[model samples]
Target: MQNQVRQLLVSLQKQLSVTLQSNRETLCHPVAKGDATEDEWLCLLKNHLPNRYQADRAFVIDSEGKLSEQIDIVIYDRQYTPLLYNQNNQIFVPAESVYAILEVKQELDLDKIQYAGKKISSVRNLKRTSAKIVDVGKSVAPRPVTAILGGILTSDSLWNPPFGESFQKAINSLTLSQRVDLGIALLKGSFDVSYTEKNEVQTKIEVGETALLYFFFNLLWRLQRLGTVPAIDYAEYLKVIDELS
Candidate 1:
């Protein structure tokens, strides 16, 4: 069973790497190429992740009516939290529903890493509210918000050694709000970083054929740890409607 599972994962990893690399090489128009890559990543997540979660390109909005910059891929809850807007294929997710945001690029470099961090900050900075839940005629207190994960995905890495000293330095340079928790260079490897209560940082990198599998498993583990998104405070949104009226 173990060997069979391993072989299946290996096949998946190879397929993902090849597909992403092919897109990078064949697509010349930057925007078209980027969109294609984003679609690929979104498809992977949507197919592999639990149905309770929704993945797409979206902008996150807060109760205050503020919107984050457009995000490449947003992993959000669909079971409870409602999408704010969906028109012409554009989606607006509420801050409370977001689980993670990923930026897709053709290559991974310091510039791209910093860009992804900035993009991540736009989503993380938004306000999220939790509302009470009524279950079985009982009122449950509002749940605290979970930290949203941020990441970057690319076909390949600019750094020769991928997750080396320079890569570490670039990741370390991000401010707390801009911190990236994960990165995947499909052709090279995958990496994840964690912070302790003391703000100490620990990084783990898987630099070989198992890059996709490592990323998929690690992402699932992290998402599992996050439990579920808090119940959204719809009353706050109602206030906006009141103002409009």
Candidate 2:
């Protein structure tokens, strides 16, 4: 499985290279909003899931159902069904099916962090209550719910000591699967630019632009190596890159 995943990453890299070469104009021309880096991460995860897992097809529901929140990504088994709890009757009804929930954050803000924790808690409570109801009312297989929190950890403090400790504490408080099925990713810009004082004057310097590309490429490669994706198909992989480009 791990080897297959690596193959997929390698295939993706090859496709990326080809796409960049073929679409030199597009690559060179900066978009009005630059690149959709967050969306790219979501897409990569969605596309890499095994065929058995239907990724990004689930919706997010609050405990009260008053506000509808859509998850960033979800994967579901074909047989799974969705259900909603009715406050009036205290009963569960067919609502929607969800395999997993994905949350994406660009920067770790306090509000977003709190929201993430609440989302996980809501999903956990829903699953537990629903399971009890199902066991008592109907004889059916149990439905497992998994929650995934993923984002670009752009904060330097998060990668360091005390801040990282706090962040990890918050994460560890969530109702994660016993198998450690939850996923978390931290992505940062590989290139940095700064100004330095030279002889009482200011000077500007920039890191290599290619560093960002390398970071992404290596990310894909490591994920593949970790068996997060299926075996690579160079032809199909290139096709995806072409479509995205």
Candidate 3:
């Protein structure tokens, strides 16, 4: 079973590499190509990550009525959290349920890296509700707000020697709230951040053609550790919305 899974991931890495290369060949339609790349990533997450997480592209919301920046990929818990603000074809998910958010780019560089950090911070900084309903057996305690994994998915890297000190420096420069938990510079390599006993951030950079597989599994481990998001206090959200109106 383990070997079969490994083979599948290896094959997927190769396919993702080709997808990125094909996106680059387009001459004048950069925006369309970018959108397609993001779509491809969404599909990958939907197919691979544990069934507990639901992946899509949408704006994340919190109980206090704050909305996150439009995210390229949002992995949330549809099983335990209620869906709010669904329209003709749009959906707004609660921040409490989001397990991860990722930005997709054609090429990753220092500038784009900073942009990704900002996007992630917007979601992480929101106010989430953990209020438990009394009807729940013995009044369940509120679950801690699970850490939302932030990442970037790029076809390639712009560093002279990708995944070297330069890339490490970029990862180190980010504040704790803006740190990228895991990522894949597909054609170059994969990177995942770890915390020391003292909570200092450490970047684990892996250079190889099989980066997508590395990125995917590292992400899976992180998600598993998070367990589940806090039970949302829907009544709180309703009360706040009424006050605003």
Candidate 4:
């Protein structure tokens, strides 16, 4: 079953590449081209991933009512998090519900990586409040919030080895809050970073035709490890600011 699923994903990836190639040559509007590419990946993920975790293009808002820059894709827990804003095609999700954010691009490069970092920081820096979920009907006190993951999804790479020198340089330049946990350059390879017990960051690079399969399954494992975003603490959203007469 796993082999069959991976084979289908590989075939779909080939189609995604073809779509990107066609858009690169025919789509004059850069933004449209980028959106189309993102939408394709988003759809693929939606179809393959579990329905409990919803993936969509939405802005993340925190308890302080701060909004992150529009992320290309947001994987959120809809079961526990309230869909804050949804009107006229625009949507906003609570930060406490966001598990991960992905920035999709046509090609992988230094500039794109830096841009993804900035976008990630916007969401990472926000204040998220969590409540302990005792069960479906019962609840307890708030708990420590989990870190939100971030990454990049690209159709191709610009560097020689794709995930080589320039890629490492860009990743190293980012601060802890701006770190991108994983990335996939479909035409080349995938890169992942993790932290050690001593707080040192460890990075791994996998370059092969099965990069997408590796990336996808790793993501599934991460989702399992994360469990679920804790219950959102609505009290944090109730600001008690006094108004002057």
TM-score leader: 1
Q: What TM-score does structure 2 among the candidates reach?
A: 0.42
Tell me how far the alpha carbon of residue 67 in candidate 4 is from the true structure, in angstroms, after superposition: 1.2
Off by over 4 Å in 3: 133-136, 197-199
Best by lDDT: 1
lDDT of 1 by residue, 87-183 (tens): 9999998999999999999889999999999999999999999999998999999999999999999989989788888898898899999999998
Candidate 2 or 4, higher TM-score?
Answer: 4
Shift of residue 43 alpha carbon in model 3, Å: 0.9
Looking at model 2, report the run of 10 residues with the lowest lDDT sum: 199-208
- How many clashing residue pairs appear in each of the predictions shown? 0, 4, 0, 0
The CA lDDT of each predicted structure is: 0.92, 0.38, 0.85, 0.85
**What would the TM-scores of all predictions be?**
0.96, 0.42, 0.92, 0.91
Residue 5 error, candidate 2, Å: 4.9
| Candidate 4: stretches off by over 4 Å | 133-139, 240-245
RMSD of each: 1.2, 16.5, 2.1, 2.5
lDDT of 3 by residue, 1-245 (tens): 46877688888888977876887786359888888899889889888777888998899988887999999998999998978877975889998889898998988788778889989999999988887656546786776777889999998999878877888778777877888888888888898888787878788877775677678878888888988787887788889868989
Model 1 regions lying over 4 Å from their true place: none
In Å, residue 226's CA in model 3 sits off its true spot by: 0.2
What RMSD value applies to candidate 4?
2.5
lDDT over C-alpha atoms for residue 144 of model 4 = 80
Superposed Cα RMSD, model 1: 1.2
